[model samples]
Target: MAKIAYILLCHKDPEAVIEQAERLTATGDCMAIHFDGRASASAFRKIRTALTDNPNVTFAKRRVKCGWGEWSLVRATLNTLQAAVEDFPRATHFYMLSGDCMAIKTADYARSFLDQQDKDFIESFDFFDSNWIKTGMKEDRLIYRHFFNERTQKRRFYAAYGAQKRLGLTRKIPADLQVQIGSQWWCLRRRTVEAILDMTRKRRDVMRFFASTWIPDETFFQTLVRHLIREEEIECRTLTFLMFSDYGMPVVFHNDHYDLLLSQDFLFARKISPDAKSLKTRLGRLYAAHDVTFQISNEGRNLFQFLSERGRTGQRFAPRFWETESSLGRERELLIVASKKWHVAKRLLAAIGAQTDIPTIEYLFDEENTPLPDLGGIQRTLEKRTRHRRALMRMLFDYYETDRLVVCMDPAALDLMHDFFSDRSHTRLLRIDCDFSDSYLIGHARRVGLAGERAPQATLEQLLPTIRNDIANEVDQIRGAGFSHHWAVQERASEEENARAISNFLDLSHETALDIVRAPHLFAD
Candidate 1:
């Protein structure tokens, strides 16, 4: 049988992306990588250096200067697929991914999962699905007059956001192809990728219509699949976990999410920070036959911290091609707090990021801990002196510029949340409720590495439900007078769905937020 092919779409954090490629390729799969042209040469160079000795790896020549919500993202993705088509003719399944994604299961397990199926694995939603796209967002993308922004040097950013904020006269939807949208991430047979590429090349009208449309990455492949394959030939899941807040912003992942990552039934989990040292180490150890192994790098950690601080500020920087306004002037601040579970915060924030342009600050308490595998290596310890941890929290809180704050039921910060609520300022609190339900039960089991003889188990699963109840009771009194948005993290799938609602509530550029929520294409992945 032909081995699987892994197509990695990368930007920033070459270390994480390249490492994922190396690990997957080592599993007898071939690799095709595409780097965005706009990325600094050093970024691409880092990937090249990492893969230099690996003969199974290949890079695409048709590199695109990918911009957020731009057609370049589609070009880069298709170009890589096209190259893979020609290069690895026998690749059984072409798995599409970003640099930040990590395999939840072993590569062998994932390959077996793909190899057993002849159908495509993707998450798709009809553009006409009122359930997924509410209000005017859907109508605007399909019916509005849109320009790809750079062609006219206009609202490049919002045009990609895919909501109503104009440039030209409304354009009619193409009669040639059906328009559909979904997560850009997918796992498809080699033949499916090739057929889509072929159709895109031969159908000039199809390409043109999508090229000018916002977030063609989401619509293009989905339409191709619906056009070429039968519904019976499709598997309706992307198997990647990308959490969004109720407001439609991506929940940033952290080390504390390690237990959550392993607990997931998904094969891939998105968006690990390139510099998330602790999380990466844990992932490496988990996948390394459950034996602890780590490549020491402090540079990745420092860079992550610096970038995180920048993200917290009102500093809204877009690609050279995008046109945007900074929300720094708006006092509409958001803080994500979950009382008991780290996954709740991740899910809520992801939902919020998807809907709004307002920058969010995450006051994460690093409880994303599970027992270390029985291997001896440099272990990261999160247990800190309570006083020191509290003091640091105070310092960070004092300096955070705020217009709105969300407390996710963190009792440690209840006093602070209460202070913000009682104040005369306009800060708002968005409370997230993550019930200790069935999802929690399964996750607790996974963190113990149970369900099979991979590791020990049993006790943590029992106490988690109780902890969930205790935290819920403690935060009942901290309601704020400012604007507040409450959301839930029910499980893996539901948590990510909320990013869109959160985005709309935050008043993100509708056109731009639409592209993100539909495609979830932040890093070309």
Candidate 2:
């Protein structure tokens, strides 16, 4: 007899929201929805009119204009929760969800599952100790006053934040309250919900403190629930299945993810695209189905394992952790070709391809044509490649099927060459120094459509010497680190001398090296 009350906070897609509301209330559970004030009034009215006839549904009287990383989100949730509590007195539990969330399991199953558990399900951890706040002000989130909307008014937000830092202004938390952080989605028992509402009513100072706190929606309920409940009575995890990309954004579900969604034990999956009609329709039918005996499958776990392995290694054939001594002992030798000139590197790689069956890749980190898997957008893809460069390179090494592989390094990759080559005793380094001339810059500019920029010409003139010095410094540091073998071919070396250098570097016969150096189509701009 554990009745559930669903509090939905929606900002867009009225049709989708209506469908979700109908599906949830079809089984007799009560729901309260709060539409953002900033959203189109017509969209909100459309949703309300569709669900008006349903006795189990109610709309919040108060609507707030919610902003990302703002207090209004928490306010919207509170408004909806208050409405649901007032309308549905018999409800024993309250679950908060966003407009994008959809029930993945049968309502009977969710009710039955909750009936067997007395603990509240939420993701809560110490705010300072946890690494959950990726790429942001961590402890500063609580200490500083964030008055501006971080999403819309980024400049003002940072300006205020900077001013506060300069003046050393910080707010102190109440000694009674322990600061905690968690995801905004959570399910709470009736008593817990009542306690939270009661605390909000009585503790005006605590609420005021959180009103200006950054991303308070994630921390508000999380901190309060921990303060109110016994440690043993809480399960520190969300019932909603959520996944984030490397860029710290939620992964949107699509039509093809139906099987993946079904395998998860969580009652709900979120951030589903409104355009995914097929996925939404199938999940709606499943949610409204009579079957209560569905068992969770292992496919979800298996999929996570596959993704985790791919994340640890690359698309290569080599094992995870190719840099480790144990993995290197069992793996093939790796040759890294470094140069300040892209054309020279390409020539060497082409030569290697012609002479030996050794797999060769040119410019592994080339932003235009990277060897890494496409990560949706160029900015996100570039950030992932650069941030996890070493891990990605190891993955690439594991991916190739060969006794020996040669990878020509991009000029942009020179900054990381020293650290990359350090302590990799199994890897070999071949450095080719070529003069960085104005003609090379001009050719590159023409190729990439930057030929008209006189600024680039002057910039290159200034940067040429520095680029050469950096290359020379990295070469010395890498050689000092002592890899399996290190060879350098100076800038003015003749084709024959360069061929001899390659032969020495690869331990190949002079005739074979000559054939590689003299291969057709060796020159490229």
Candidate 3:
């Protein structure tokens, strides 16, 4: 009884677009409608043949000719939704997506999530005042009126001229107007859709004002939604995991990665270039997201296990896929701590097994009382036994020389293990707890004392003489540069004292970990 609708604008890449459409249709809760570039009949024919059998996918009968930087596309989308709402009156929600968008959440879970929110989940993109949207029109109008007396490039000029001709605007430009400038991909409740359309009718003047803007898509709905939600404070985070890019990461949430479903939404993707060797074996790889680093063979098993787990959880604990630093062979001695039932662990271990000489150990933590197999007991028992511990450590040391460990665990485990290694030497630890807020993992590691034959705290006086002057110079440079966080390099002999001193200083200053990275010179490089 639940329904959602997708509207895809087809410019090119018909196969890729239809393939993604068919995949979404397979989920059985939604329908997909495609709007090809009306001029490209060949593209439409090809797409139609490919999707002919998909009962859920329907090609729009009327052609919509969209111009660059114009409102036509937005208008087409609105018209399509208006028709869909009338046709499927029982459908409670609708989502507008592009050909590039693939679903990352399954139909049921996505629907359930929308049902719970009971409000629109359109991202507030600051559309009205987005520089990208304003730059085109303002720059065009200036060029038209000879504001600067220099002839610039004519792309936006043409766009603005066309918009002006299409929709007459005789008045001055409006400032302090903020619109939502984001991707058209949005999930909206039925009432929200009606509200937007009804408000559009009431605010004809505002709508007419935006129709002359080069990027009317940014102006129209964003302005309307902001006005409507102004009093209610309606907020919506993006449904897709694209925001993960803010952290210098290509991956999304570990649990909610909808593999095939993710291909529908276009965050920005390039079609595979023509230089590839063969299409059959290589095209899938070519179509994969550029930010994704793993190849198909490497990702297949992981994807399979991930999907299986989602099926088991009824897709509740949906996680995204993340590649370890080892995926690129830049690091060694990778360790993963995960829930015993986490399906991705199997594929992770498989990848580890494929390595030639590397030793990869996966520590499956029993987070929800799922008793691990015999391997768990064996590994834990080995950790306690001095002979086993020393022998394994010696082998690991000999093989890796300098042990680089990657620990994947929750906060409590990170805290406990960080405390355990506070006094031990000969081990280097890094924690991957991207799911949690705060950088406490790094803080905990910094507070811990290092172990080894050479005590950093004991020999600081001996080595301070070697780098003490450099430390002062660096500190002066950092402070002079207006750096709240500074990094300084010193001899390893002063590691423990240095960490303690820096930790205390940061605690007193109430500065974030990032605020102190500029002071790395405070520790040995």
Candidate 4:
């Protein structure tokens, strides 16, 4: 029988903490809790009074005023762990948890699972080699001293950090310790816990070194455990299911995530919302059930896939459910008709507009020719438009009241083209390969100021092959991503032939092709 001891570091929500503590110790297991000294005295008294009846529950005698990303957090954890060890002599395993965490599975199941495994389940990895720390100083976190609380006193923190950098004042880790970093949550066997407590008693120098290190709670125990255990004795993964946002904040679980929480194989989950009463009740029932079987669901994976796609392509505006063959639904379709030659793209847009009732605009993304309002000056307008290109496109669609509109774009706007190419569901692209005649190249070179040793025509002639190859490679990549595209070479095609090709590519009726042919202004330069 493997009895477990839980050490909970709580700072808020006394009622919720009481509920979690009662549930975890419902059986004969023991628990040690440390309430932050900074929290209100009333809240602490409530939690203590509620759990005083339970003989297995104990409170840390040395509570600290914990601050985020500060040494106080590690001190609180140490106090709580020490309390659990002295109180629960029969406990075979120790699990570190937070006030916001809850058991998603039965306590019996967790105890049984731990009984079968001899390994310590923790997320420990080499700090210097891993990319886990997304923002802030990586190696500097260990090399430099962090005396100020980064969360509350950000200005002082950065000032001190800058001074340290300028002065080159640094510290070195003890020769025996290899620094490791990981999440603060972990589950350790009794022997691992004993060894860690023993080290803290004997190793004052290492403790002093870590006291001034930034966010030592994340690295203190993680690095020490690695020094004490063999690589084979540790599992470099957390049993708690935790996720962080792109901004490096924890994602809180709510009522809507009930199914996602139940489906995960992890025994516990953290950072759950205190307001999620319904989710708490359901998970509490699941934890109390003895015969319920856990099954993995695809809901979690589908969410991650959707987020990944959104990261690659900017956020999606149109509802995916709006996809249909009806005219109203087709209004969500946007076509970017582009060509190397501006006139060719204009002609294609006209041909497409003649075939369909969708509105058409010429050079909508061209910096010089865009229909958008000018922002003070040319350079300023260009900067604003480029920075908020996605927002501008959404504004364009909203202003037109339809995404079915076609817009002519110069191939030079590759950034905008890449966006449309990435979205295959609601967008389509057509690239026209027209002849880049010497006469046109000469005019283009002079307009853009191609000043070099060689003549304008000669300079363009030298660059033409590379430009063509780059366009071809871009088109190949778009095709590889399963984007709907049509590549047409209009260098030798007649006006009527070109109109008919555009009509067929856009899935327009043959009668509309004749209508485009009759409109001679569309082909005029």
Candidate models: Cα lDDT each: 0.57, 0.74, 0.43, 0.71
Predicted model with the maximum lDDT = 2
Which stretches of model 2 miss by more than 4 angstroms? 298-302, 305-525
Q: For every model shown, what is its TM-score relative to the native structure? A: 0.53, 0.61, 0.41, 0.59
Best by TM-score: 2
Instruction: For each candidate in turn, give its C-alpha RMSD to the true structure in angstroms.
Output: 21.6, 18.3, 21.9, 20.2
Candidate 2 to truth, TM:
0.61
Which rank order by TM-score, best down to worst?
A: 2, 4, 1, 3
Model 3 RMSD in Å is 21.9
Q: Write the residue-wise lDDT of candidate 1 on 1-525 in tens digits.
A: 547777877755576567777777775678899987856688898899989888778888777776555577788888888777788877888888877677766665565556677789887677775365532246565555445532122234355544544444566777755677788888888778878888887888777777777656777788788888888999877867665432233344667667666656567787665336788777764543533222323243344445445554745342110112111122234444444455445444444444332223344334424222111111124343122333222223222312233333354466555444443333444444444565565565566464443433455556556655555665454433233554332233342454544444443445554444444322120
Per-residue alpha-carbon lDDT of candidate 4 for residues 1-525, written as tens digits (9 for 90 to 100): 788889898876788788888888887788899998967788999999999999889999988987667788898888888888888989998888987788887777887888888989888888888887866578888889998765344446788999999999988888899899999889998889989989989999998989999989889989988999998989898878877543233555778777787788688898576557898888887766787777876366467457646754757443221122211122256677777567766665555554444556677556455544222232136565555555445444433433355777766676676665555326666666655555665555555565344565566788666555666676555445554555453556775676666565555656776676555554344
On the 0 to 100 scale, the lDDT of residue 311 in model 2 is 60
lDDT of 1 at 231: 89
- Candidate 2 lDDT over residue span 1-525, tens digit each: 789899998776688788888889998898899988967688888998899899999989899987667898898898899999999999999999877688888888888989999989988999888887766578888889998865344446889999999999998997899988989889999999999999999999899899999989889999999999999999999999888655344555778778888778799998675457899889889877886565577476466557656765565343333233323222346688877577777777766755554557667666446333233232246565556665455444433323366777754454555545553435677887665565775555556564455555576566556555665676666566655577776667667896788898776878888786676644434
Structure candidate 4, residue pairs in collision:
none
Clashing pairs in 2: 314-395, 316-398, 316-399, 317-398, 317-399, 317-400, 318-398, 318-399
lDDT (0-100) at residue 513 of candidate 3? 25
